[model samples]
Target: MTDYTSMANGGLPRISPYQAGKPIEEVQRELGLSEVIKLASNENPFGMSKKAVAKCAEALNSSHIYPDSNGYYLKQKLFEKFGYDPKTITLGDGSNELINLIFQTFINNKVNVVIPAYSFVVYPMEATVADAQVKTIPLKDWVIDLDAVYDAIDSNTRMVVLANPANPTGTAVNINKLKEFVKKVPHETLVVIDEAYNEYQKEEDFDDTAKWIAECPNLIVSRTFSKAYGLAGLRIGYMVSNEEIASLVNRLRAPFNVNAIALTAAIEALDDTDHLKMVVAENAKERDRYVKYCEDHNLYMIPSQANFVSIDFKRDAFPIYDALLHRGVIVRPLKGYKLDTILRISIGTHVENTKLFKALDEILKSLK
Candidate 1:
């Protein structure tokens, strides 16, 4: 019998596939529910900007033509809006793809990769696929221990990964401290910071890491329109680094890597500042409600600057997660991440959140 698994790349066969949050339609079909609200994937509760949506529709007319291979217009938009250097930018299908590209470009079995615990999961996964040695650093009080991560790096370390307002835990590192860490890292090791939830952070906590690219040539910053910009389905993102790194990653990027509609929508999305502001403001308001809910219920809600909250049940939470699912409220269970006692729930609109609270109240009563 043919053994295809043995022929697979490094750790591909040994690793489990990424389990994304279930779509509303899939839950409806599986459970025979008429209505379901998904608070699993940390997507923007508000849909895409009206301007972006309109642009996407208009772009449908050009579907037959290939998108600009280099995404020139979108790069120009980023440069105009954020003062990013177009030469330092590399377009990606999503920040996930850029992460993979980084590992593929630099990582090898002889080198090691440093990552903090409770990260985005893609970090270690991509490193493993690249056949790199993985170094997992422990968190300090539920947040990434930057100092520990620094100590883990050695000459053989090829990369260090961090996610600001990190996933699952929703805890972020102080920006000033992060800058210091980046400066101290050796020039030989690449520092990758995934800021997918950057827009959701408070104004006081935000700082543009891309500005440091010139000073720290080994630094790479990746961001996406998936969360705050509300373009998850379009899968548009970009990476910022020195021109040398950008050029290397570009060589591996597929032509027309970004589709025409995504490019159009992303360009418009960057321009619609009002819509982005509303999404961030509403997310802040609703996120507070989740904090209070946890406090009132005697649960611990991790401090989150992102658009989601992770509550520690202090015991296996699968039962509670299942109950919520049956009641037409879908939230993330962290069993796969080995954080079985915690569940991460995305902030939704007011009405949706109210419905979730009501359903949760009923479920809690039944459990007691």
Candidate 2:
């Protein structure tokens, strides 16, 4: 047999696959535990909205038909809800697909993309896939340093990718700072803000990119139904941008990229205000409770505006993660993000949070 690895692009060697949180079923089987709580992946602990569920069931009756290639109904509903022109919208299998499509639309080997150092890892990976250079700006005080990011931009910079309520840290930049950065960026460069956790933002000064995108033609805001909407399994996300840019992105997208059920579910999920409110409220309460627990336990944690928290155990987080897993609890270890002493935990239900705290308390006691 021939070795196929040699035929691959040289740049492919530089890419590291994204690591998602471990599944609860796998952990349960491995540990032989009947019950397990997964406080990982930043997933909404509350189940999906009833309206979305009903719509999905309705879609099942037409499961034999292909999804609307243009995602017409969902786009129309999104336009009505968000007030963006339908022509400016582009749907994706998920926000991840939207990230990849952005590179496909605008990137070339000669172009370079700028990203925050500790922001979403997908930005760098997508740039690498496009064979484009990546300039990573390190975060200052656990928040994106807009000044530093501005300094990194140059004539060759084609895109700047930022994740508000950034993952692994959950910090957000102020509206004034983000607006100034947007104003200073060159017109030729595309500014992409990944707002996957926008619904969870609690800060008063959080930048609303939707409002700014109206003035900045080069801006793109990516959002998903996975977080507060509780539709991760369906993999539906969309990008709002200038009509011209959206056209380019649409050209790069696969036909029927979103499934029939997902399109229907997402449209219904938008009308689920009660479910959205409940998730937002529960997440806020659990997040505060977790933060308090961290403080009381003397574990240093970053102040988060999202549903997840990153806590520094002042020791190797891997051992604690393994211990938690053995106890039927799953949390994300941040070793790959270069924070070996930290673990990221998503906000769960009150009962789940109690179990996590109990497991951690026991683990900490054993460690000492």
Score residue 343 of candidate 1 by CA lDDT: 88
Q: Candidate 1 on 1-368: residue-level lDDT in tens?
A: 99998999887876789999989999899999999999999998899999999989889998999999999999999999989989999989988899989889998889999999989988888888888899999999989999999999998998999999899888889889999999999999999999999998878878999998878999999999999999999998999999999999999998888999989999999999999999999999999999889888888999999999998888788998998998898999999889999989999999989988898788777877
Superposed Cα deviation of residue 44, candidate 2 (Å): 0.5
Deviation (Å) of 51 in candidate 2: 1.6
Best by lDDT: 1
User: What is candidate 2's lDDT per residue for 1-368, written digit by digit as tens?
Assistant: 99776667636667877888999889878889999889899888997898889878988999999989999999899878878788888999999999989988898789899999887878888888788999999899999999999999999999999999899799888878898889779889999999999898876866558778778888899999998898899999999999899988898899999999989989988988888999999898988898899889998889888889999999989999999999999999988888999999998899999999999999999999
Candidate lDDT values, in order: 0.92, 0.89
Roughly what TM-score does model 2 have, to 2 decimal places?
A: 0.97
Total backbone clashes of model 2? 0
Off by over 4 Å in 2: none
* Candidate 2 lDDT trough over 10 residues, lowest sum: 5-14
